[model samples]
Every structure is written in structure tokens, then in C-alpha cells.
Target: MAEARRMPSETAPAGLRERKKEETRRLLREGAARLFAERGFEGTTVADIAACANVSVRTFFRYFDSKEALLLPDGIKVFAHVEDALAGRPADEEPLDAVCNALLAAAEPFAASTLTALGHPLEDIENVVTGRLVQAFSAFEERLTVLVRRRLPADTPDADLRAAVIAGAALSTVRAVLRTRRARRASGMTETGPAPLPRAFEILREIGSAGRP
Candidate 1:
């Protein structure tokens, strides 16, 4: 996060320059997040992201190797592992169940928040833009849709739509879980549940009985 130049007399010109750099970096990240949301990840290019940020293409490269890089360090690799995990699921498993299990199986890489893993303290997560946070859930939902489609019969009517809905629901609990963790952190409370990722799925199961008699 950038240090704000709150008062004109409080900082030197050099400090103000540093603040400008921080602002540019932040703008670039936020721009990438918006672009990712507007266009699918693979569909968005570095130039598009740079233009969205109002920065030069070269400056975009200076900050990140690719647009997806804004989502996380080694984000490409993390997504690949998730795709591979999904591919190896049991053929007979339910699509939603398979995706949740696959994410759990590959959960180690996601054990830490992207910003925290990048060395930012928990509270300094202001740079973790909200749209960027949505990227993980969007990315996983996209992966689930593609992989779940493969698992369904070719003749399955509206297979793509079905996969997408399942994908959306598949991570609905994850969104809930992330909110819970954030609220706990903000309140200076500690988690007493089982391990965090598994605990999220436990929530999925608990709520799975939503309308049962």
C-alpha cells in the first residue's frame, strides 16, 4: 500500500514521488482486477490491462509479467494445479462435489491469502483490491465449469449452463468462508474451528440440508 501524502508540510518531495509510484502501482493492480472481471482471464491481454490502468504497456510489464499475474504471484501455476486436480477426480463423483474436493486436495497452495503469501501483513491488505479478491472465486468457477463440462455426458442438455451453475454454487460456501475469516480477523478474534479450508467444506455440508424436512 502507498503512504498517503496527507499534509503538504509533513513530507519532502522525494516522499511525494514515492507516493506517486505507489499510486501508479495501485492503479495498475486495480485496473487489472476490473479487466479480469469484465473479460475472462484468457480473453484479457496485457495491453488491455495497461490501457485500463492508463499506463504504458512497458510499465505494465515493469509491474507484472501478465494480466493474470495481478491476481497472484505464480497465479498461472496455481490455476494449472487446480485444473489438473479437477481432471483426476473420480468419474462417478458428483460435479459440485468433485470441484470442492479438488480444491481441497490442492488447498495447500491456497492456505495463505495471496497478499499474505506475497509478504504483506494481514492488515496491509488494502492493496488487495476487492475485484482482485473476486478473481479467485471467478477463476475457480471458470475452472470448475470447464472441467465439469468434460465430466458430463456430451448429450447432456445445456451442459455448459449446468456446469456454470454448479461451479457458482461450488464456491458459494468459499465466499462465505472467506467473509467469516475476514470478519474474525477484523474483530481480533482467532479461529477455533478445524483447519480453515476443510472447515469451509464442513460449512457446505451443514448448509447442504437447507430445505430438508
Candidate 2:
């Protein structure tokens, strides 16, 4: 019997390798967050992350080229998930409601964890989160403005501008809420609180409706 020769590039093995790579990436992220929180992000190095994940420095490099990438997490995935949530909303639903639901749903992971389970101490975490939110929302506001303009009727002037203003307001509201929540926690309020995203949107909607001509 003649034996079949295998090709140089076998897809099944490649797919399995990719899956393992993804697993390593996630483990490294978790390990990095924990380490960064414990020792401070500035103090942590690639070697520390690798050691925490039980992987070699070379393997860590394969997953993330630098330490900053670990802290940022997956922006593309987060945005895509949020976009999908917005898309799922009923066509007649108010724009604010749609956006609010999407953001809150996307934030479920943070909501599920205890305040301290986020790994970083209050001040450090606030800096990291606030910096990232500012960057992300700055870009997201532009995209959302375009989306809102396109989705709404053509007769609407300044749709894009209005959308951008709403998005900025939403981001500000969320940031303020998070700051308040952190302060409340610090003051010995141990209650597991609801995410402020939805509440922020509610306020935005109220204000928008009131200000309407």
C-alpha cells in the first residue's frame, strides 16, 4: 500500500495552533493585568508578564510586541460588540436608548466583577480607564455621528453635529458616574451598584427632549 504524503501547509494543524495562540494571548492579558495592578503598570515588564503566565519572554513577544498592548486589551472586539448591540435595537427606538443599551451591555464584564476584582487600585485604575475612555470615545463619537446622520431622515440638518454632541455628553456622563461610584465605594458603601451607563443615557434623553425646539 502506498502512503499518502502530507502537504507542507496543513490547515487543521494551523487552526489548532492559532487557537492555542489565542488562549495564550488571553492568559497573558489576565496575568498582565494582575501583575500590573500588584506592582504598578510602570514597574511591570514583559518578563514579569511572561513569568506570571508561565510562558517564556519570546512567547510573550509573539502575543504582544510591547507592554502597552496588554493594558489596552481588544479595542476592535469591544467596538464591534457594542456596534452589534446598537444594531439589534428596534428601528423605532430612540437613538439614545439604542446607544445606551449597547454600551451597558458591552460593559457587562466590568459589572460582573467586584469593584476590587478589576485588579488595579482605585487611582491607578481610574487613570488607565479614564485615559482609554477619552481616546476611545473621541474616535467613537465621530463614527457614531456619521452613523446617526446616515440612519436618520435626510431633512435633518446638523444630524452629525447633534450626534457628536450626544455622544460626548454620554461619555462625560459615564465618566462622572464612574468617578462618583468610586468615591462612594471609598466612603464605605459596599453595595454592588448598577452600571451608570443606562442612567446617563436617560438623563441625556431627558435633556435633549427638553432642549428641542
Please list the residue runs of candidate 1 whose C-alpha ends up more than 4 Å from where it truly belongs after superposition.
Answer: 1-71, 111-122, 125-133, 154-158, 209-213
Q: What CA RMSD would candidate 1 show?
A: 15.6
Roughly what TM-score does model 2 have, to 2 decimal places? 0.67
Model 1: ten consecutive residues of lowest lDDT: 122-131
Q: For candidate 2, write residues 137-184 as lDDT tens digits.
A: 555666666655555666767877767765667656666666666676
**TM-scores for the candidates:** 0.56, 0.67
Q: What tens-digit string does per-residue lDDT give for candidate 1 at 72-97?
A: 64546666777888889889997778
TM-score of candidate 1 to 2 decimals: 0.56
| Backbone clash numbers for all candidates listed | 0, 0
